[model samples]
Each structure stands twice: as structure tokens, then as C-alpha cells.
Target: MVERATSLACDPSASETGRLLTQAFQTIRDDLEVRQAFPEAALAEIEQAVADPELPERDETDVEFVTIDPPGSMDLDQAMHISRDGAGFRVRYAIADVPAFLHEGGALDAETRLRGQTIYCPDTRVPLHPPALSEEAASLLPDAVRPAYVWDIRLTADGERETAELYRAMVRSRRRYTYTEAQELIDGGDAEEALLLLKEVGELRIAREIDRGGASLPMPEQEVGVGTEEDGCDYTLSLRPLLPAEDWNAQISLLTGMVAARIMLDGGVGILRTMPEPTEGAVARFRREVEALGAQWPEGMPYGEFLRTLDRTDTRHLAIVNAATFLFRGAGYTAFDGELPPEDEQVQSAIAAPYAHVTAPLRRLVDRFGLAVCEALSAGREVPDWARAALPDLPDVMEETGRRAKAVDRACVTAVEAAVLRDRVGEDFEAVVVDGVDGDRVQVQLMDPPVSDVATGSARLGSAITVRVERADILAGEVDLRIVGRDEQ
Candidate 1:
């Protein structure tokens, strides 16, 4: 997952720091050649198709689905409703039907193919489809009846998959909720039946993930914006600790994706998201780092379980989690036809499962194809000719777009970090030596402002130290800091 940054709803642009942040984003976009406007033909196609979408004959609108997303999310992708099913649970997940508007195979299709997926920065989003479709027409907005691929998954009370199926249907989301709101409702124990069931099933799925040896980096996302007196500053960069609801919502998506992978693999044709397990060398190195931070990785404990024990709030634990990123390397798409990829070749190492990206079609190009393949297979029909033919090229397209998206996200993070620290240059602060990326340079996580940047000189990885910021340049998205002293306590 991208290290996502949130944009708080404050007028950061009203301050000088905000101006620099804006300029930095614009420069990054310019250098990277991020597209802002849709091609004329794509826009024209959108105009022609927006009002009239091809809805599937099967109407599942009776199910009350609700969307859980980050605040300010417009290109909503997935909606879910969970309920009791005798001794099991029934999960109805609706993914926005992007293909419902695209059989013309026209300029809009070409445009979405070129873009690949939505690229999100703190300031703006470069959507896969135009706003007319992604944020509207095709989006599963509340009260708007829209076409969708609904995954009907039945899970035993223990959260084991009992049965799963996918089909196209019309769906309507009853309401939209930000993760925080959902958490509040769930915590108060006064939510609707679906949400209450969501909590139960979500916890069950989480335990399943832990038991299956899957790990997730539970690092808090950093958000920067104009700060109020309530925040005790004029501008602030702070961590937004994820809500329990967010993890629960994600479990539903993962459940659907894994089930979709099963469907496609059973049919012997589809794309699978694949990654290799961490190397012995990587594990050894991580173990060493963990010991250096005064943490214990018990003998024979799965690395995932070990990771789940680390608290993200502790300075040493934060560094430990940051170092865990190395374990998630080399993830990519695996498209297949006529036969399945080798067993080892199909599993996503981090997820520890054979997974496919079948959710979030509005944001991702590949999911549209994956969903088409899975939906066809689950419906006992031939995979669409167009989907089968495009399997070979999907990997490369996704790889290229993935690289671009990462570069942009990293650039935006850097600029924001620089902006946050520009006024504090020359100040000393407590930090943890997270890791060394290059010769004589280590990455440090600051305590006061919650910023992570490269600093000169070497130190034991995960060791506490004091660092002096020598310079910060928003335009360059760079910060110069030096290790002045090591923390003894």
C-alpha cells in the first residue's frame, strides 16, 4: 500500500508554508508529467455515456449497503453489507462497475488504460476515469442506484469461507461514512445490524489473518495542514492513527479479493497479485534490528505475529515498523491463461494468500479486468474475449503506473516534510535511527513534529539519538540534518 498522506480541511494555502507546499506539488507534477485534463475524445465519450449506463438485469438493491472510506473520498469504490446467515455470515460487497460504461472501447477506454489507477496526493487526485464517471455516474454514491459487481461471500461463524460467488447487479449505498464515524458508531454499540455484524466478522477475519501468518504495517499516516490554536501551532504535521473501523473495512476488501482469486484460479484463467516470501537474509537482518531496539522476536514466531506485537507509538517500535517495509518488496501482477501459475508463484507474500485485485475498479485499471474474469468464471460462463486478450499487457501497464504513483507519493511526502520543518531548521530534537539508506546517511524519525528524513552520519539502527536540522528546502523536497548526540536514556 502507498504511504498515504491526509489533507486536513484547513486553509494551509493561506500561509507561506502552504504556498511552498503548493508550489512543490505543482513542480513535482510538472516534472513527472502527471495528466490533469481528460483527452477531448474521452471527455466527449464520458458526456455521451454518463447519463445512460448499462445496468445488469439482476437487481440487488434491496440489500442496504453503505460505503466506508476516508473523509472527502469522492471516487467511492466499494460498499458492503454484512448480516447473520444461520450459523454463518453473509457478506455482500458491491464494487463500482466501471466497465458498465465502457463497452464502446472508445477513447475513454484508451484514456483509463493510459492512466491505470487513481494517483492521490495530499493536494489533489489524478483519477483513473474522469470525475464525471469516477466521482459521479459510475461511483457507488449513496442513494444513487448504480451498476456493480456484487460478491456474495458466506463465512462460517469462525470466519472460514463457506462459499463465495460473484455476479453483476444494481446496488444502492444507504449512507456514506468516514472511518472515524464508523468507529464511533461501532464503539458506542448502537450501530445498524450490518455494522455490528461487520465488527464481529471483521474481528474474526483479523484473527484469521494472524493465524494465516499475514502481516500489515500499522503505521499512522502523516497529515499536514494549517493548524489551529487547538493544535497549538499555526501549521501542523501530525500523525493520524488509523481507526479500527478502517482495518475492519479493509478486511472485507481482502476477503473479496482472496475469494475472487479462488474463483479465477479454479477456472484456470485470470490475473493474480503475486509476491515472494521474504528472504532468509531479510529476516535475519530484521531480527538483528529488532534486538538492537530492545525488542524480542521469540524463537519460531512467525514474523507477522512478531510485527503485530510492536506498538507504533513507541519511538523504537516505530523504527521497527519502518524497517519492516523491506519484507514487502517485489509485489507485482501475475496474469495467466489456460493454466494456473505455480502454487508458489500465485500467493502474495505479505497477504500470505492467493489474491486478486477485484475491488476498487473505479480507482484501479487492473481490477476491472480481474473482476470481469472472476465474475464470468463464477457465473459459469466463458471469460470475456477482451479480458483474456488483455491479460498479457496488464502487468506491464500496472508496473509502470505503480512506479509513477510511488514516485509522486514520495515526492509529495518529501515536500510536505520539508514544509513542516522549514521554520524549525537548526533546532535539535529526539529521534530514532530508523535505517541507513546510503553511505554515511541514516533515516531518522523525529519525535516533536513527527517527521522522518535523512540525516548525515551513521548510528545503530533503531537507536535513539539527537539530531539538528541544518536545512529544509520545500522546492527540492530535501532536509539536511546531522546527528549531534546519542540519547543515553
Candidate 2:
């Protein structure tokens, strides 16, 4: 974990940051043995695939699907378009079909299995597949004919999915749009006709999902800015907003996931992604805590439903929602060979029953496996032996990979935030109490600047207070604050 810092010199060229990032990559390389046998062969095969010019082509200029991604992301996976269909919605999700080019037991597939997913550091990226495949031949680039797995989904007026069909086809992305640009089109009073139609569909989908039991949280995120020095990376804490289009796009994925789950469940011989209902004990404890804080929890409601209500009634319940996420237990890959795992007792009891991962095949190997299963089942063929064998170990592998990705992401963000705040040591700021402790340390939230920190006893969760930044270390990634006084209101 990195600590917050108070002050640091800035480097315009990001040279210093690049070096540190290189070291981080080196550490990952050694840890995963990425430089040795795994990635080398994979890279060669990928380069060959990219250079090959003989491939099928399809006309995609009419649909005009555009990509939404982070700036400078070349390994684009998804492009989408939404249209209205008689008071309903039509969503076309086109994903880069990497599997189409990479052989089943080829170098790229083997390497991807080992790496699990792409790793993003402050200054560099460790892609799961080699760049030639992930970024060039397989990437859904604009104006270039490429292979794709298209999910054409239709939804009812109320957002219930009516039908979905998947097919391997050719696509040409019309444009590459960033989240910022898509958001502007959504927020600006005048949006393109197609974008406006997309917004309407997206809003309907989000509204319907929220009405069901989906949980939405506004978690703060940090972005990295490259600079000139050896360790010169400017870390900025930036809030990534969930635009209507984003939500709408997500709904398409979610709908597909649910459909896949249902398909596997019906077949009774495939892995599914499952999340269990919240435990009675955990819910009870949370209820007591909320009531203790003079908050209300409607009785006999499911946890997801309860969370939606809390979102409306208590603003501070956001943290509680985060905490409750842990109680829901981890969802994982579960394989079945005609015999279902016991309904009452399973190995990973935390997850809801019958789990599968069918989204983001480009980003997750497990999803690729799941997609293969769906394809086989859809074709009425026997389940592939290799996929079934891999299923048993996928839960642990995915879990470990997910944990590592989260840790690295958090470390990078904390390092950047520390760098950003290091210069403000000793400056007084108004903060809200996010977590209150009595003996030695308490946590406070700076409302205007919107940062959270641990301070002395004068601050408690939900209490407003004043605090002064005492210390920040960019190298150590540490941020420390001292209690100035409690806010009088």
C-alpha cells in the first residue's frame, strides 16, 4: 500500500514516473515469469497473426458503432449502438473476437491463461495477450474490417430482455470515442440523433435495473498523469462518472450475463457466476448499526432492495453499502457435469447458486471459457473436455487474479493521491467524519475537496470537523492529518 504525500517536485516529461513504472513492471515480470517462456512465444505468434492479410471482411458502415474507452487505450474490446424499437430498445454489442484468430492451444492462448488479465500500472500496461493480437489484428479498430462476436439484444419497454442472439461476424467501428466525449454528448443540450436515442434506451435500462435489486455506488477513483522525471508521474484523484450511456451499455452486458446464466442452468452441466443473498446475521448487525445511528431500515426486505431504499433515505449509507458488498460473498466459477452441486451446501457458500462469467472475454480468460461453453451448448454439442477440466481451478485463479489487480490499482491510486496532497501539509480543511474512533485515531472526510483520512479523536463518523494536514510522503505514499477542532454547527 502507498501512503499519501504532502509535497513533491513535478517533472513535465514523466521520465521519473516511467522508470518507477518500469521497475513495477519488472517486479511483475519476475513474479509471473512473464519475460521467460510464457510471453515470448505468444508475442511471436501474435505478430504473425497481425501481419497476415488474408481474412474475411464484412460491411459495417451502416450501423456506425463507436468505441468508448480510456484515453490511449489501443486494445479496445467493445463497441456499441442503441436504437429505439417500438417503445422498446435494441442493443448491438460488438466485442473483438480474439478467439477467432488465436488457436485453441496456441501460444497466445497459453500465455493469456497464465497472465489472466491486463495489468495497468501508472506508466505502463501488462497486456494479457501480446500487443499484435490484443491491439492490432483482433482489436475492433475504426474503419477496419475485423472479426467480432456480436450480441444483438432486444428489450421490452420496461427493460426486460426479450431476445438475444450471438454470432461471429465482421465489424468496422465508425469512431473511437472516449468516456469524456460520450458524456458530453449525453450532457450537452444538443446531442446527435443516434446518441439521443441511445440515451433514452440507457435511461430506461438503468431505471428498470435500479427498480429491481441492482446496487450503484459512487466510489472515488484516481487517475495517473505522466511527467518528465525518473519518478515523474502526476497522480490526480479524478471522479469517473457513470454516464447514462455507460449504464445502458452495462445493462446490455448484464442482460447477456443473466441470459448465459439461465442457459447454463437450464442445461445443468456448465459453470455459472453466482452471488448469494445476504446472510441474516450480517443484515441484522447492519440494521442495528443503522438504527443506533438514528437511521431506518425497512423490515423484511431483501438486502439489495434495502440498499436501494437506504440510498434514498440516508446519504451516508454509501459506506454501509460498500461494507455490505463483503457480506454478499464472492461470486465464482462453478462447473457441473450433469450433477448439480448440492443446493444447500457448496464449497464457496458465499456466492449465490450456479455461477458463470460470460462478459468481457477480451479482458478475462474465464469469460472466454464461459463463452465456449455457451457456444457448445447453443449448438447442442457435448461440453468440451478441456473447458470442463479448467473449470474446477478457475474459481481460485480468477479470485487470486482479481485480488492482485485490485491491490495494484489501489496502490497506484494511493501513491498518486499522496503526491497530489503532499504540498498542502498544515493547511486547515473542513472534513466530514467517515469513520470515528475514540482511543487514538479517527477518520474524517474533507467534504469540499472530497478526501477521506484518519485523524485524532475529535472526529467521528457522520460528524463534521476541521483538520490540518500534518504530513504527506510521496515516496512512501503516506498521507497524515492532525485534528484541529470539531466543526460547530
Residue lDDT tens for model 2, 195-286:
67666676766565556555544333434554333544444454333455565556556666666766676667667665555576877876
- Badly placed stretches (over 4 Å) of model 2 are 1-38, 51-62, 189-194, 226-233, 288-329, 342-355, 436-439, 442-444, 447-458, 468-470
Judge candidate 1 at residue 120 and give its lDDT. Answer: 79
| Span of 10 residues, lowest total lDDT, candidate 2 | 345-354
Cα lDDT, all candidates: 0.85, 0.63
Superposition error at 179 for model 1 (Å): 0.8
At residue 131, candidate 2 shows an lDDT of 68
Please state every model's RMSD to the true fold in angstroms: 2.2, 5.1
TM-score of predicted structure 1: 0.95
TM-score of each: 0.95, 0.81
Cα error, residue 402 of model 2, in Å, equals: 1.3
